[model samples]
Target: MARILLADDDEATRDLVKRALETDGHTVSITQDGAEALDTLTSAAATFDVLVSDVHMPGLDGVALAKRAIAAAPDLKLLLMSGFAEELDRAQALKSANLGVIIKPFTLDQIRAAVRALLA
Candidate 1:
């Protein structure tokens, strides 16, 4: 089991992802946007093993968040989600060993597997 931090602006997406990961026995903490997720990552008492975030968000986008999160916690793993090809391309540009990307409209199993890949 892993301690995961998940960030997505959409409530339904957030809830669906939270449940999907939890079903896989991972402890998930959620935030509505990247800024909040960053706060949780930097200030929270508990250190997260992985970060699952949406690529497009209001204030701080997932790509920016990923960059900052990695700097703050070098060992943190990243899984970014997006339906847009351009955004996915942006996420891929980071090119970190611990980073991964999932397309939106994903099945629960797909998301679970993506997170599992990062953990593995």
Candidate 2:
């Protein structure tokens, strides 16, 4: 099973995604804020196969976190999710970060497929 870091500001959304990923047999570590997510990635004990994060948050934000995380862990697989696809598209950092983007309101099937594809 792949180890995944799930970062989202919304508690409900985080819970939903976490349950879905866990149900698919993946191990998950969840963080409710972008800063916390970054801290986890930078932590000495932090290790994960993939990172799934929301694009917008109070601090740091997903694209910034992904960029920093990738800098620290070049091989880290990143999957970014957002309700605002337009905003994500406009964020040049996201494109430069080279991470996969999943539009929000995704189905469990979509999440499972993304995890499998990334892990594969």
Candidate 3:
């Protein structure tokens, strides 16, 4: 199973997604905002197969988090999710391997498939 870091400002959203991902057998460490997420990623405990973050969050935002994380772990896989997914900067996705953007309002199955696809 893949190890994952999940970030979102919405508690409900984070909880729901984290539960879904965990149910899929991935080890997920979750944070309430992008800044906390970045801190977790840069910390010594930051060993993860992928980062699933909400595109719009306070302090850092998902794009900035992605940049910082890639600088720290270039081969790290990234998955960005948002209601305004199109507003996400695609440049980061191009720079990282296994990067994907998933639109919000997704079903559990959809999110599971997206993460599995990243691992595959």
Q: Best candidate per TM-score, number? A: 1
True-vs-predicted CA distance for residue 118, candidate 1, Å: 0.7
Residue pairs in candidate 1 whose N, alpha carbon or C atoms collide under 3 angstroms: none
Report residue 64 deviation for candidate 3 (angstroms): 0.6
lDDT of 1 by residue, 1-120 (tens): 999999999999999999999999999999999999999999959699999999999999999999999899989999999999999999999989999999988999999999999999
What do the candidate models score in CA lDDT, each in turn? 0.96, 0.84, 0.86
Q: After superposition, how far is residue 97 of candidate 1 from its true place, in Å?
A: 0.2
Q: Candidate 3's residue-wise lDDT over 1-120, tens digit each?
A: 999999999999888889999998999998988899888988896789899999888889888888888888987889998887455655345566668888889999899999999989
lDDT of 2 by residue, 19-101 (tens): 99999889999998778998998899989889999989888888888888889898898888888967578444555434677
Better structure of 2 and 3 per TM-score: 3
* Displacement of the residue 99 alpha carbon in candidate 1, Å: 0.3
How big is the positional error of residue 88 in model 2, measured in Å on the Cα after superposition?
2.5
Q: List the residue pairs that clash in candidate 3.
A: none
Q: How close is candidate 3 to the true structure, as a TM-score?
A: 0.92
List residue ranges in candidate 3 displaced over 4 A: 89-94
